[model samples]
Target chain A: DVKVTQSSRYLVKRTGEKVFLECVQDMDHENMFWYRQDPGLGLRLIYFSYDVKMKEKGDIPEGYSVSREKKERFSLILESASTNQTSMYLCASIPSGLVTTYIYFGEGSWLTVV
Target chain B: AQSVAQPEDQVNVAEGNPLTVKCTYSVSGNPYLFWYVQYPNRGLQFLLKYITGDNLVKGSYGFEAEFNKSQTSFHLKKPSALVSDSALYFCAVRPQSGGYNKLIFGAGTRLAVHP
Candidate 1:
């Protein structure tokens, strides 16, 4: 079975603070993604990494960055967290670039910015 | 670009009754569709996927989906609903063309099963 683990289940940060959310997948998936899920708006992609050191912006990538230094780990960074950034963040990984591949998700990190 | 739409925001059914969660998608080429379930406060769980071949895809918890090419629909169905079946269901799609393709998700339908 594939397991995608998130470093934190719940986190709190003050406005303008820097925050980091980590995700690791045991399957050695080549594509990793970061997304923020909000009520009504659904899940919006933040960033994605297809390979080490390679990143691409998603639908809503503002104020967020990602790092994939290794095949198993992917990190989402909020350079300056804001109250509006408080949401459930999800990390997902897919084994390859094929569109038929299914993406696996971590439990999720709930960020509260005050 | 690929996209998905779940026409209904919620679908309510009673226990022992069949239920359906509607999903439609738009993609330029062949579509790779999927169904996922999300319990509150938890991440989305993969239920099933339609890559090729069969139109009827059976997944965990007795959930199944039918892929219709003419309607551009991949509707999720279950013979009988259980109370535990209540969850947020999302339908996603990706184009068959290869690349770093992302799965486009629908807003999701909240399924409520009453006993």
Candidate 2:
């Protein structure tokens, strides 16, 4: 079974603080993603990494950045955390060249920016 | 770009009754449709997906979804609702072409199974 683990499950930070949400996958998938979940907005992609050192912006990427220094780990960084950034963040991973694409997700990190 | 629409924001059903969550999709080419369920404070779990061949796809937790090409819909269904089945359900789609692996998701539907 594939396992995606998030470093933190809950966090609280003051406004304008730097925050980091880390994720690791045991499957060695080539693609990793970060998403934020909000009521009525569902899950919106924040950033994705296809390979080490390669990143792409998703639907909503403002105030957020990502790092993929290694194949097994992906980190989401908030340059300046704001109250609006408070939400549940999810990390997902998928292997390349699969006939049927399926992305596995971690438990998620709930960030509270006060 | 691929997109999905879950028409209902919420669906209330009684335990033991059949439940259905509606979903529709739009894509430039043939689509790969998927249904996922998210429990409170947890990430989304894969329920099922429709690639090709069978129109009716059965998935985990006794759940299923039907793919209708004409209607451009892939609605998730369950034979009987359980109290534990209540969760947030999301429908997603990706275009078969363009080597696109990113999935566009719906706003999600909250399923409430009353006892």
The best candidate by DockQ is: 2
Which interface RMSD values do the candidates have, in the order shown? Answer: 1.2, 1.2
- Per-residue accuracy of model 1 over B73-111 as CA lDDT, tens digit each: 999999999999999999988776645545688998999
Candidate with maximal lDDT: 2
Estimate the overall C-alpha local distance difference test score of candidate 2: 0.92
* CAPRI tier for the interface of model 1: medium
lDDT of each: 0.90, 0.92
What DockQ would you assign to candidate 2?
0.75
Per-residue lDDT of candidate 2, residues A74-97 (tens digit): 999999999999999999999888
**lDDT per residue as tens, model 1, A24-68:** 999878888998888766688889989888999998998998888
TM-score of the A-chain for all models = 0.96, 0.98
Count clashing residue pairs per candidate.
0, 0
> What ranges in model 2 sit over 4 Å off?
B99-101
